[model samples]
Target: MATHPTFITCSSVSFSWPDGTEVLDDFRLAVGPGRTGLIGLNGSGKSTLLKLFAGELTPAEGTIRTVGEVGYLPQNLVLDTALRVDEVLGIAATRAALHAIEAGDVAEEHFAAVGDDWDVEERARATLDQLGLGHIGLDRTIGEVSGGESVLLRLAALLLARPDILLLDEPTNNLDLHARARLYDAVDAWSGVLVVVSHDRQLLERVDQIADLREGEVTWYGGTYSAYEEALAAEQEAAERMVRVAEADVQRQKRELSDAQMKLARRKRYGQKSFENKVVPKIVANNRRAAAQVSAGKHRALHTERLAEARERLDLAEEAVRDDDEIRIELPRTLVHPGREVLRLSGLELQYGARVAGEFELRGPERVALVGRNGAGKSTLLRTIAGELEPVAGTVETHVPLRFLPQRLDVLDDELSVVENVARFAPEATANTVRARLARFLFKGARADRPTGTLSGGERFRATLAALLLAEPAPQLLMLDEPTNNLDMASVRKLTAALEAYEGALIVASHDVPFLESLGITRWLLLDGELRATSPEEVGSAVR
Candidate 1:
């Protein structure tokens, strides 16, 4: 691996939530000047670590040191809608001072405000242009920009500040392909220390190294995400082999212990028989018996010790194997016949001016992928079909029962447990039946009783998905909007596994091409101003 001087360090760090939930404990990290991909399962404290580095959160114990200024872009970027673009860029005052001086105000305070940055406007415009936001005017309000554009704008602001350390948390969560490319370009151009917590494979592929956080510790992998995966796979393979060898050794030890015990019993029996037959004098026989018993005890202790040691080695070997469970669900009731008409859209005019002229129909268990650029009204269309939105002009008809899982995962009630939430969806299901079904969704035992509000990002998603798929009348037509947005790679794989078993019609809106392709999508529809049929190969060009 390439090496660089350490620019940031955390020593003996510890942090916990006010609710007494421990996050990081005695954590130590050294970050150098390179793009590092920080990854872990949901709730692994990747975000919290970034927040600590960015000084957004303080460590309960230990010291953190940074060599230069830090800029952080949180996962949920919430900017005041009313703030002007210049204001958000943190140059509104400087721009105002420059303008005043240009208008012949020439005050001392204005000069002080402007400082040496007489070309601040030019720099801001150039930064915005670099991020593919040149069209967004400095005078415009944040509300005027799209979500993807807003993310880039935040990054642009950080770039303008010329910070030496930058931290981005799930920067590509809601971004479109074009915006993601722009952000990737920005990452490529970064020369300072950069750490990004993201699950986007394409984004992680650009990193110089992988920092895997698990069980309150960070393990460094010497390359990109793919390299890390390869390394981890090799490690697991070795661990499994060791486990097999250890298991064999344990079995061998157990057999030896059993054989030794049998031999000792046989020896005792022979000794007792000899004594009964009076082959030797009573004193000599008794002495022989005492000697035999002592030897048997030693033999038994030796075998027992060996067996215990072998079992201990087996346990250590097993602990090396990872147990990342996958969701395995079967929805037989959701199956649709090949000739069944699942849904139809007639003269569909979505709330955001995107429309489907004429008619659109879905039949049987057809899988549809909704592909579009940001602000292309994909979500709006899905919402319209799901009855959450009143279409400007259209008719949506569903022959089979349907369900929608939105991007926010707000279908769950925060106060309710996972089982309770699922019960609400499937009112007719008995409590025992609900619990049995939840186990298939990977929520067994106490996990099913966890309140929705306290679940992690991945857990919350699974719970919501369970509630939808396991509803009273199993939904035959399911609509999902950006389902993989913030999910980790493992969670994404689990989602794919769950969907593979879903025997129903699916309409998923996503920018993740790999995920879409894995679903065996029969149709690809691009939503711009109008819905149009397209192929997977044509999606990029059509969206661009």
Candidate 2:
């Protein structure tokens, strides 16, 4: 592997949000030329670190140094729909200048604009092609392309810049399988210092190293994400064993202390009895009793100190273990019979995007994965099925109660508490009943009473899901659109865990292969102007 000098360095850096939420404190990181994947749970400061490196945010303290130019692709990239592809790619001026010079304008400013970048257009085209965006012409408006294509276009822009340090945050969050493959290729071929913050396991697998950020500290792990998982598993296992040992030691210390106290009490009783029986002179007996009492107190103090030290050891051992809990809930009321027709679509055509010309049926407790590129109408289709949108062409028939969790997760009332939002769905249930159900979704006690607007992305998602699953009439068919978007790996796992307990028919639209596979999908449909049944293996192999 070719190695370069450290291109990005952060020393004792500190950063906080506008609300004074401390994200990074005394953070130190030095990265050389290679691909490094940054991963952590949500709210662990991964995005903040990238922003700091890109100079989008100033550090509260310490220094940051970089060797050369830097390019950063933020997680939530919102490009103006009115902007043309060339302008978005930052090549409009150069292309215009080249055109002027080619027309024999002989303008000095045009020459200055086209200076050393005479082949800029060709380079831009090549970059676009590399990122699977050749079909998107530079003159086309941004509104003409899909979300996935827009992401690729942005990455192509960064690639055209050819910065020494490249930072990508959740670059594959909205990409399909084909777009993701192209991104993986780009990462594989990158020669400069690249740091990407993503929860995509496949993307992380292509990294040269893994940097796990937890509690404002970074722990470097050699090799791919799988290697890091193996190392972490081993570490967690050892830590748990130590906790068991420490707990046992604490128990033993307490017992020993109790035994010492009991012995001291018995000896004190014997000495008092001897003094009362007048076995020696009264003054000598009293002095002997006082000495015995002092000795017993010293003995008890030593045992008490040992017990405290043992309890401290137990606390330290427990701290070494990670506390990541999966969502566990039961939805027995949502069960569907094997022969029941849950949903049916007959010649349904969406308002804008893809259309279904043929009849489609979903029956029983089938778990269907809806895989498609962005703007292929996956979300529109789900909304149409949920009756949230009126189709322009055909009909959607539902045989049972169904609920849809939109990608935007706007189902909740921001002003209302999580419990109130859930209660809105389950009107017949009492407030206590709603709170009881929300607890299973990890919203116990005051957490259930927090306003929906106050929750983080993951927390908001959980709250929305709770509202959906706890709805009245017990939805027998659940449709989720891009459910894993913006969720960390842990949150995704929690979502999967929560879904596992749902005994209803499910249709989840997502590009995350690992998450889809984990759901035990019995059917796969590719949405590309039409819905076609496909296999998981075909899904993996069809990413051309």
The lDDT leader among the candidates is 1
Poorly placed runs, candidate 2 (over 4 Å): 1-32, 57-67, 329-332, 337-341, 351-353, 373-375, 386-392, 408-439, 443-457, 470-474
Each prediction's TM-score against the native?
Answer: 0.89, 0.87
Q: Which candidate comes out best when scored by TM-score?
A: 1
Q: Write the per-residue lDDT of candidate 1 for residues 420-533, one digit (tens) a residue.
A: 999999898899989998997788987788677656666677788888877867788989988897677777887887788788999999988889999899999998899999
lDDT of 2 by residue, 61-100 (tens): 9999988788999876778989999999999999999999
Cα lDDT listed for each candidate: 0.87, 0.85
lDDT score for candidate 2 against the true structure: 0.85
Which 10 residues in a row give candidate 2 its minimum summed lDDT?
A: 324-333
Clashing pairs in 2: none
What TM-score should be assigned to candidate 1? 0.89
